[model samples]
Target: MAHCKTSLAAFIFSSSTDQWLAAPSKDLSGLALDKHDLEEMSVAQHYIPKRHYAYGCFYWDWVQFGIKKLLLLDTTNMEFSTADLPPGEWSKQGIAIVEAGEGRLGMFGFHSETSSDLSYTVARNKGESPSQWQMEKTMSLDSGYKYCIRDATQRYFLFTRVEASTSLENRLVVGYFSMDIKTLQLQRVYEKQYYSQYQSYTYINFPPSLLSSRRI
Candidate 1:
């Protein structure tokens, strides 16, 4: 796998092996607001660049990018397209949401890279289709990267590296731009992780081969 910004939480599941992708986000619009929704209301574009590809499995291959909307690749022709979760009205980036047993939809979790900070805004999921993008709230970082992951109940487990010494290594930094749902305030959450390795060349799996090997 490549250096992925996160796991397959946002990816849509597909059995085609060739062309499949998924992106999970808060289903707000008074329908199903997830965890990220608690922080923002307006929607804006949040680009998931190619620098954070990390360990991924299952639906991971379908993720082309996470921009103003979630993008997936059409493995049959190596083309990219949209995912099943329609981008909210005026949404920027998508946040994968899961409904907890407590009857609340919230963000499962997300991972970011060193190049950019993860931020979110809210928007309406109204109109005719799910592709309608929207924006609601924008804010700055609140909790550090250590708060990215947590249990289903929202309890968190954070692990980060303090930059005490300078070394020839690349580190993963988690930055969050907080947005208040009610007031539309924004804050930032910044933290870092280290990977003391470097890469000079990159290789992506051939879509054709990736398809043929599938049990389909």
Candidate 2:
């Protein structure tokens, strides 16, 4: 990624050379990019840290001059590109990039600050023409408690539920849950017995051997 005030550039770490090498630039003639559009482009500021990997590509959320775009890093060719965010009112609060089945990119987010419904949209024909977003599904969460999206990856997103409190500092996280993007299933991964402030959650992958039981 490029540093502040520098021309946009991407580099890949070479395991063989043990050094960072410039990534090969791909022909972006098909995209709507121009020199002016990229003049102030950067990945450092207003960048969403939650990265989603799908179909040999990594996706991130980037906001340039109040316009939101998805920064795409194609690992297959070690190239970088950008895509426009899906149309409509999308809040940055809980937005997440996820892998839609059949080698497609999908995004999940709430419609509004007070809405209890979470919407999922998938990008169709990405990189061919201006990508089209199709609404796949909408799931409603429990309206009794307030919820916050903490992190997301693959086909799952981690969220926290807290009792509504007027003061941010006084808010207490009541539970942590994981929502399956495909099935829209909500599963409680953890419940807090004592009061605590909101915190980040991470997904951990355990080997099959550790998850399975074997007779000694």
Candidate 3:
């Protein structure tokens, strides 16, 4: 597994060892899928390192025409597969997946009308019905702000607010915060202090990844 390239890389993770290893080569089809195919990954865009409760990792497929799909990669056995998305949840433009709590996969989504308020859901890979998602929580932030991680035990997000006016236009404040999603409680985490008034701020959650680019 030694074929590595700047444009492409593959990482192997072992839950038992609790460590990460980069594939010696990225060209092995059985070991890794071509990175080009990731362009079609769903709204979550990139895989964020969270809890791995099973033998593989899960991903969202890009909305095609009007359909979106879930994909899972088994690093343990070197296999790839897809799962069905919870009904109507995929079409929601504002959707996020995160480590909800208790080692379960959590999903957050919003209706077409409100981008700031998101409904929470968790994926059950085992128990009575595996691979099923159940709703847990929902929240709506004040105007000009949005959530970064939805339904997580500790949720973090960014927001923008009209703070003042300069010359003939208004000024805004871009800020970040974390909260207890279940309790609807929040605390200011960070504030940008300065930003473009007319432009909207885009929030991207950059948690550490399940894999590393460096070789073992």
Task: Give Cα-based local distance difference scores for all models.
Answer: 0.29, 0.65, 0.45
Task: State the displacement of the C-alpha of residue 192, model 3, in Å, after optimal TM-score superposition.
Answer: 1.5
Candidate 2 TM-score over all chains jointly: 0.74
User: Which pairs clash in model 2?
Assistant: none
The candidate scoring highest on TM-score is: 2
Q: What ranges in model 2 sit over 4 Å off?
A: 1-3, 8-48, 63-66, 126-130, 193-198, 207-216
lDDT of 2 by residue, 50-169 (tens): 566677777655432334566677777776677887887665456777777776777778766666678888888654112788998888888766766777767688877777653566
Candidate 3 structure quality by residue, lDDT tens digits, 1-216: 111232224476789999988643323234233444333232233333222223245343333323344444545544445455455634333345555656666655554433566666777664211367787776666745433332222343323333323322434455555554445466765566564444444333444484344211
Query: What global local distance difference test value does model 2 have?
Result: 0.65
Per-candidate Cα RMSD to the true structure, in Å, reads: 15.2, 4.9, 9.7
TM-score of 3: 0.48
| lDDT for position 98 in model 2 | 73
Badly placed stretches (over 4 Å) of model 3 are 1-9, 12-67, 89-94, 101-103, 124-130, 144-173, 180-185, 193-216
